[model samples]
Target: MDEHTPLLYPSPESPAEDTNAQCTGVSGVYHRIGLRLVGSLIVDSIPVTLSYILQNSTQTVSILVTGRLGPEELSAAAFSMMLAFVTGWCIALGGGSALDTLGSQSFTGGNRPTDLSIHFQRCVILLWLLFIPVAILWAFIEPVLLAIGEPARLCKDVQAIMRILIFGAPGYIAFESLKKYLQCQGIMRASTIVLILVSPINLVLNIFFVHYTPLGMLGCPVALSITYWLCFILLILVTLLSPTHKANATWGGLQLQAAMNLKSCFGFLKLALPGILMVGTEWAAFEIVALAAGKLGELSLAAQSVIMTTDQIIATIPFSFGVVASTRVGNLLGARSAIGARNAAHASALTSVLVGSAIMTAMLAARNDFGYMFSDDEDVVRLVSQVMPLLASFQIADGLANACGGTLRGQGRQHLGAIFNIIAYYVLALPIGITLAFSTRMHLGLKGLWIGKSICFGSVRRLTHMILGQVIGLFTVGTAEYIVVWLGTNWDKEVEKSVVRNAEEAKRRTLLEQHE
Candidate 1:
């Protein structure tokens, strides 16, 4: 059998084993495993998180700049963003996760290096196809929102915002696919590097397009579209020109064959649909909360926005860690190193706790001043302060849920994560949150919503462990290979060393791509 194929073909189903015992038997070199795992995650996650944070910040900067023009401009931009988030953007986040599975595994699996290239092609085609419906849906958003009883003015403005925004859809999803494709291969720094460089350009473009050009409100989407496409283009250039990519020679020039495999396209869908739901359901639930907050009154909605925005930024830490965990597990599994995959998951959980505690502390420290960053109103600031404690608690719980979610993705069990999220947020948190948020006696508003979410997070954390245990079952894992993906990741020269070693061990690598 091809050595890399073991991950695809597991040992026969067996009797259940103690989860604690299985985790303990991870290895005698647990200390080294922990260090390596932490190092790998830090390597992959830091820059990735930074890049995404900056990217989100750049968009925020654009909005802030627009807010200066008038409240109407700001409202339209924010509403446009909300609609984009639920539709095209959700597809990007979740659908790109498919690469977290297939791309990572294909690199270490017994496939030609070109397999990664083909997989990249397949993802681009698949995501673009999925985005078509979304683009068409954008065309009709005005009437839809109006029919649903959104204010006619708000719907009219939002419609104008989306019209121009839909053109950017291709660039957005394409960037995500490429980002995941390269991330799985260890070129982690390129994203941050590109975003940092282009984000300023986006800011400048927004200014010029809005005032200096004829686009007016349409400039917002147009400038952003340009930014997204540039980010995508820059990444492709960086990957092709980088020495590490040349060393691997993973990209054969793109060809018709890259998009020809309809069968594999279906496989991508199988993995992607669950990832889509996982990210989509979470985002949707939050949007619902935003709408609920809106119903409570303008103050409540503004306060929720302030709190949620900060939380979203802080969220990058755990979300990035989960990305690290997913990539690590997928890489190890592909190399048939079950021990390594198991160790990666357990070590990541510990790392998340440590990180979560720190984030919780930071949130508490900033509670008094956090709202002022977004608003000057004393009521909004005071309201945000009341909820900061709950928000802090939610961070820790969020850490656990996201950690488990990432591991589940690595295991190619995203459907489980999706199911858990649906139950946690939709079935559990949303109902309770709405009840508390709207009750005349309770009228908890934003605090109630956050509190309910905390409960949901607890449930998600517990269920993650149970689900992980079930999927992993029993296996004798060994530290035979220590993989470090995301090539430009700042994690020592280990990845560089791996490349030199891999070149020398080409035959064996073709069979397993094992790391020493």
Candidate 2:
């Protein structure tokens, strides 16, 4: 056997002996495990959450600048953001979905997994290449906006923003690739540190470009692009400092063959496709809501932005938990302890609920203050406040779905998650929400959009949580139960085999002694 392979089987042990040490629940022995898991998650989640907030603060600044320019500019910025999201950010999610799986898998595999860095580099190159055609399509953005009945003036502003953003697509993809690399090595905290470092720089750039330069709305995109590349560089530098990256065979060089292996490359694309669509579909649904509101007029569009900004900020909380849970669950699964993976998944899911509930309470209590953080206008505040309840009510479900989805992805079950997302977002949420937001005469208006989102979020949460929980029980706990049962049923047979082997070894030893 290879030195790394363990071929020697252990002596057949009685089930009773094992059961004597098996943890019953979270009472005594399990309690410490639970605390450690939860504590680790919280510790990791904090920096990540702060990074997300700081990163998004640039958008806040952009919106503030746009707000000063009046409604048309604000609408233009919103339109431009949606376009940037679809073409660039959405693709990263797809590529990143693959990264999350492969990265975690490699971490589990040890030194050999380190060689997978070449694969990561190859994937990033492929994504950047793929983005070229998409970038070229930026020229048609104005026509598309016009086709959608967007105001001519707003369409022009959106075009400028799109042009600037498209220029930076390669950098954006690179940044995402680096993030996955760090995340997979169990050194995810590094990316958060880089994000924190880049955020203030981004803010200053945004201010300079908007106020000092002639870029105006275009400066927002310019600033963001610069910050993104900065974030990428920082991650790459920090990651290279890690011992694991040092020990890896795939760290350096432009070995075209190794860097561009098609078979493995295609596999990654396949694994990531569904995740890309799932996130894209959900994001597209929101963009549609914003578009529809824009057609309604500036106030509706502004209101949507306010609600969305808040949602995006708050979303980091659930997202932080999900990322940690995914890593933890992936680690346990890769370790081959199905029971441990199940426990980790369950703990993560429950922790999500607790976190979500806390966020829900906080948001609900602060519903009155939701808009003031952005603007002093009574109309925007009133509209946002009216929609706050719907948004707040769905927080727990949203958090649960995010956490469970991460758990599932960590287990290489992203396809299952993608299906749930399609059914929830497309079949249940979009149609219903759009109708309510546009057609309803209940005087709810944008509030209807919020309600529809809540409904979608709630539906997805219940379905995913229930499905994931059952899966964990069947795969993890059920596997453990089978092992326990088998150990009990065939204890005598195993013991006999062990004895026979031992006797044969003794006979060989005596024969060797006589020959000597």
Candidate 3:
């Protein structure tokens, strides 16, 4: 080989360019991207998860600190936390999915991408606009709780918590919007850094305000609200300083035409609304199980809470993988690299399955240990131990469903996804599970709940795999291969032709010179 000759790999134009090339089959590049995606998921989830844990943690903490408080305080804290979780999570983060969809398209489109500032502005407008009714809902929360069947004393406590938590809505939404912007820009490390710094601060604030300070229950939301604003500020500060953010025109002045583009803004709402409902319905369904467990009495409720917390932490692993896949697939699709999109989906799905299986095994091995750590009561530990196997059993199927849903959402097929989830979870899975839970007499009251959960999770997994199979067929596999083969063959032929032509010309010149 010539010293100056460069090595060439098989490409679509010259050879078969494997769709797998874009996948994590490559070493350093694959792992680096993987780490970034996983890191983003962990970092992004920390505050939210901590918020989830902290909010829940506050109930017990409140009960502990507020000595002699009756069931009223407990129930109020519960309702407040519930309202906060549903609103903060479902609205703030849910509404921000518009960024995952649009920001992705913009990022990949690069040259002709929509104005980042306009997208940000429009989302902000829509987010704030959506905030009005939810805030109103927060305002009338007492009457609503009263109407729903909550005890009068409990209603008062709930009302106080609602009013305080409600104040955090604007901060929650604003911070979430900023997070989406940073994530879309692939600048999640900054968000992570900020959150790590602020979360402990929030925790300390939660303890001090709830236990010692005059704030009481109100202090929790106040602390959480402060952290949310802190997150937004840090993200904005990072956005201003990052070269990548500036390069993407994320800091561009907002054009009224761009920001007020109702057509485009509504387009985002169209994608986001169903996406929100898809996940929300599933969450609400699970909450129902928890509610049902509450009916089983305090031991059952506490046991379920402890189990659910551990379960949720485990659940985040697959969901996090889904997040990574969604971002990767969305970016690829937005680039119009259909082959790459397909490969990314396949890779992500496979990763979820393997990871899920591994987690399940680990959970099974440590099932008794996990339950024992949460409670010293033999009865609670024994009950939790019985339930662990069921949770462990559901992991694989659950992971597949979660990961596939992410892929579908990234593909701009959220409508189909929403329908599938509705049918799979609500129509089919939940019904079967509820029947097994309530009607079937296995003497497994709480375990029965998990039995239904297992069935529902499994059904969704099967459905997702089938849907993915059909979608995978639409990928540009044959076309990409054809392009690779044709480019290679034709380009080689042209080179051969040119070489021959040059050789003939050189010979002719040599003979003519000899004759002269």
Candidate 4:
């Protein structure tokens, strides 16, 4: 069928009458839908969460294995991984997010199923093209670090590791893109399976390369590179050989034309650029906090490391929730079910709050002892105990923001989320944090940094009021604003937009196909 042909499903302008019928019993229907959506989101999020935890462990394992080499080796591996997280990993996450919008929509949009494949191809091509400069930068990073007045020996070590890791950058980005491809098709467990199969191998490889093979400190990256490529290959095999063929139905093979489609490439970037900003801005802000923590003295820095590491692990839950929300909302939109999309968004927000609160309670209960998990230093443990409450307080806000951000992504409104992050973190939270952290009078120290972040994450109460007085917390403000916006959204309009978006893509594909 030509692209101009009508979708097999009801058009947005003429939604199925049953949707209207359900709206008549709005309260009961919505309650049922919310429960069902929450259950589905949780079920979907578990595998995704496990996948992230496993994937993250690979890098952490590398650090653990290599850190035993010496302090300098440990420092180099840690620094190199941080740089990789900000640059290549962020690009993979943010760049691949475009597929979260387009691919999910396409899969349910009733266009040719291959449109999902086309979007995946476009994402892979763009991200790889983007990685070229990153690789080049890694090759020359030592000079940049030196220019910044970093220790020369440390810079040299970091540069060496980065250069080795560069070989695997494409594999990392491609694997992320492929995960999105499969995820959009409802194949959520594939990546988890791949990681389950690869994690042990990764650990073995790290040991073999670093100790047995004589590669020394550099061996960690080599093992990592091999592990990344293996993950990508295994995922590809899973897609090809799966009994269900959910992913296979969408895979149209490696079409050179799809990758080379200029219009499609630009379309992907439209969402991707904002997605990059959404991820990078928040991540960079945390990194900035980490750098500032280092300036506070070794004790404070160590405490900050403990807190940050725990936060990253805790964050995977909301992050997974966001992922599931994005896919569900996008699928509902593509299917022209405005009510379903709206319910899913609400359910996602509710789920995040409930989950975040539970996490916060647990963290609070463990605050006194949590630091012992990372370090035995009394000073560091004491400082971490002091700061844990502030961190715990904002979990709900973080969860809400993530859920809302995911909803925005599914609705093709990533730019709005990016804007909120920039304003909240950069303009509001960071400035307030740095000021309080270093202020001669306040003397809040590590607490000040977290307080600033907590404000951005949504802590609003007597403490915040006492600190800032009339000023509202950014996290509270941003998440509230996001909820308001979502409440005000016209899901019918969103459905229309999704339909129009898919139709335009189909038209473009048709023209390209005809020309070919």
Winning model by lDDT: 4
lDDT of 2 by residue, 1-516 (tens): 211221111111324324433665434324534565555666667866776677667566676676566777777776677677776677876657666665654455433443347557766887787677778777567888789787799888888887888766777788878776666555656777787778778778877887788877778888877877888888888777766556544354554555555655676677677777767777887776766676567777777878887788898898877776666555544444444445555566667667877887888898888789888889888878877877777666777777777765665556766776677667866666677667746545776666556555434334333233422322242223223322332223322332332244334434544776
Could you tell me which 10 consecutive residues in candidate 3 have the lowest summed lDDT? 2-11
Each candidate's number of clashing pairs is: 5, 0, 2, 3
Top TM-score: which candidate number? Answer: 4
Whole-model Cα lDDT per candidate? 0.71, 0.64, 0.59, 0.82
- Estimate, for each residue in 1-516, the C-alpha lDDT of model 4 and write its tens digit: 211223222233544446544564336544545454566677788999999999999999999999989999998998899899987898999888888899888888947888888898889889999889989999989999999888999999999999999999989999999999887776788899999999999999999999888799999999999999999999999888765455237777788785677887888899998998889888889888998999998988999999888988989999998898888788789988786777777778878878988998899899999889988888888899999988887777788888887888888888987887787778777888899999999878988898777766542333355256322344455356555656668889999989998998888878878998
**Candidate 3 residues 411-495, lDDT tens each?**
5556655675577567755665556556746445777676655545433334443223321211122123222222332223322
Judge candidate 1 at residue 498 and give its lDDT: 28
Tell me which of candidates 2 and 4 scores higher on lDDT.
Answer: 4
User: TM-scores for all candidates?
Assistant: 0.83, 0.79, 0.77, 0.92
On a 0 to 100 scale, what is the lDDT of residue 407 in model 1?
68
* Superior by TM-score: candidate 2 or candidate 3: 2
Candidate 1 residues 1-516, lDDT tens each?
A: 111212211121212212322444335425435464566566667887898798788668767766667888888888888788887798988988878877776677534777777778888888888888888889879889988898888888888878888878898888888888877776777788889889889999999988787877778888888888999999889887777678767786774444444556776798888888888888888888877888878898889888778878988998998887877766666565554566676667667767877887887898898899889999999999888877786565566667667767766667877887798788777888888787999877787787665655645334333223321110000010011112112222323322332343334334343432
